[model samples]
Target: MNEKLLNNTACAMVAPGKGILAADESTGTIEKRFKSINIDNTEPNRQAYRDMLFTTAGAEAFISGAILFEETLFQSALDGTPFSKLLASKGVIPGIKVDKGAKPLAGAPGETVTEGLDGLRERLVKYREAGARFAKWRAVITIGNGIPSAYCIETNAHALARYAALCQEADVVPIVEPEVLMDADNTIEICEKVTSDTLQAVFDQLYLQRVLLEGMILKPNMVISGKKCPTQADVSTVAAATLRTLKHHVPSSVPGIAFLSGGQSDEVATAHLNAMNEMGGGPWALSFSYGRALQAPSLKAWGGKVDNVADAQRAFHHRAKMNSLASLGQYNDSLETVA
Candidate 1:
């Protein structure tokens, strides 16, 4: 299983001053993102957009790894270099998103379970051969009225553990993600409770499945208030709550926790992470594995224009650099105004 390789890769994914870039949006998902900018979601556009991000000068300084979708794994740069090869050349680990998507769970209203374990072992073999050293599987836990049932949490945790086992068996570090969605009107306390329970369940299943904790990175939602909540948490408050929940639930054996942006604005996400790092003292490294929070600015700058490539890349580099500084507790509002 190459345990050393898995552990080393997992550690590198959250190395000091670095984090993962979640460029693994599926076709449908990227389509929605592209639609927002009035860009046609064509193959060429997708390739170009990703190419821009990958080729951005100095991005490798902050981006330790890039999680790719299936198509992106095989796609090439404008110069014909494979995306995986391009990223590897820049000292970035290549990872794949293995989950099919979330589906409605029967008997659990307003809940979902992430699918795609049907042929994961075989797929992992293929992804490994294609230069992927890690993989991600996400399980969504919605917070709503009378929901996030025990059944739903258990079912998703079991799936995540199974997927992690498969990934480790194939020598691929797994990013086990159990996101407690922030789409509800719930308070920060409710978010904390849900995130804590979901993480505890995930670790329990990971133990039961015999997954190597050191060979996996946890991608969890930060303990924060819901979008519709009256009182949004301040940066320091969110950081403290997130660290408290993580320290209580996540085993120290795990190499790191790479937080999903969920629905946080780019600045807000970076601020929260910076606050956490400033507090320090966690057993494992804390970093980001953001999608929209990382990509939104770049996408807006690109705006489907060839002339905007440099601007898009600059925007991407700025965000990545901000998160990089945040990872080391060096970011501040002053840095935001620079350049």
Candidate 2:
């Protein structure tokens, strides 16, 4: 592992007023987007969409880095410049999502284990050569009645540690994402218990695997009630729950904790993050690693029309700007989303 490179990469990832843009949608996932727009999910179309994001006229204003899928890491723009090179030229670090899709854990029923780490070392070396400075691996944890057994949590945590070890060995900073899902109808207390347990297990595995905590950024879900819980948490409640849970499980040695949107409305997600930053007393830098929460409004505005590109960029820029503000505890939903 190159300690210097790891330190540089980690610092760049969480630079103030800048956060990651997760454009690393898988082929199947991109296909769904194409479906919405009546465009075929061909390689060219996928490349174009991603290129639009990475090559957006002035993305570096809020985007310090971009995460790409394996295919995107290799594909080139229309003029033949590789996307990785394009990002590097624009002062944005290029990262890759190394995890294969999550699969259902045998006997656990509702929980899933992320599969990667099979030949991960070779892949990391090649990605490093191909211009990737960081890599991400996500482990999904679900909450429910009689679900997400201890076996499921431990199995996922072990895989995450293995992946992290390989990343550090190849000079790549690892974004260790253990998302405790908010899809169940559980209370905020239930969500906190599950998230706390999941993070505790993840860090334990990281320690056992000899991973360097300083070179890793944690991407976790904020502690909040489930979507159908009949009672949604207010911004302050969500902020308090998330902070309390992280304090109990996450160590101060970790450099940052970027929260995943996990099906939250863009405004709500930003508001919650901003609230946490306002309430700040934590050891790690708090930020975001959102997907849909960062892009949904822009996508809906674009609607896949060539004429909508400028509008799309505008929408995208707005969302990015708001989240950047949230990162600094300065976002006001009423100022942006509220009319």
Candidate 3:
């Protein structure tokens, strides 16, 4: 394994004033995004949609890296430039999504464990050849009545560690993601406790599997209230709780923590991240690896129309810029009213 390469890429992924873009939506996922905009989810459309985001005039200024699905990694832009090459030419490292999506855990009725380790080593080699320097694997932890059992957390953690080990062996930095979903009606305190337990379990397994902590990035959900909760925690509260949780479990050796939006709105997510950065002095870089939070506005602007490309790019660039400022603790709520 090339420890230096992995660490360098991981650090670059969360460099100051920048964060990762999760353009790795699966076909089924993109279909939903497209449906919202009245566009078909064909391969050509998918390519064009992502092409718009990748080719956005100066998005590279804020987007340090982009995680892509396998099809996107191997596909080319309208001018025939491979998507990975296109990103690299603009100084953005390319990454891949290796998880097969979370599936129902055997005995845990409502919990899930992310799978994809079946033949990951070989897949990593191909992904690397396709210009991927990093990869992501997500484990889902749902909070509810008598749920997120020790069994579910351990199984997912073991899988995440195994994947990280193989990724390091293949010289690819892995983004370890254990998302405790926000779909419930649970309070922020419950979310915090669950998030803490999950991270502790994941790290324990990572150590047991000998995954190099310095060679990977962590993509965790912020410690926030559930979507169906009676009231939501404001930006400052979420930021403080999340930072506390990370300091508690995540090793300082990890280069960065690129948080997942996990169902947060764009402005809300940006606000939370900004609040965290403004608070200052975490051991590792705190940034984003958002999907819908970064792309929703762009998708709405484009609506798959050729004439709307420029507008879509503008919307995309604006979102990226906002998050970039948020990463540096320079973002302001009033900036949302600009442009």
- Report lDDT per candidate: 0.94, 0.86, 0.94
The reply for model 1, stretches above 4 Å from the true place, is: none
Q: Candidate 2 vs candidate 3: which has greater lDDT?
A: 3
Q: List the residue pairs that clash in candidate 3.
A: none
Candidate 3 lDDT tens digits, 238-292: 9999999999999999999999999899999999999999999399999999999
Which 10-residue span in candidate 1 carries the lowest summed lDDT? 330-339
The alpha-carbon lDDT assigned to residue 128 of candidate 2 equals: 93
Tens digit of per-residue lDDT, candidate 1, span 200-270? 99999999999999999999999999999999889889999999999899899999989999989999999
- Which of candidates 1 and 2 reaches a greater lDDT? 1
Candidate 3 has its poorest 10 consecutive residues by lDDT at 330-339
Stretches of candidate 3 exceeding 4 Å from the true structure: none
Q: Ranking under lDDT, best-scoring first?
A: 3, 1, 2
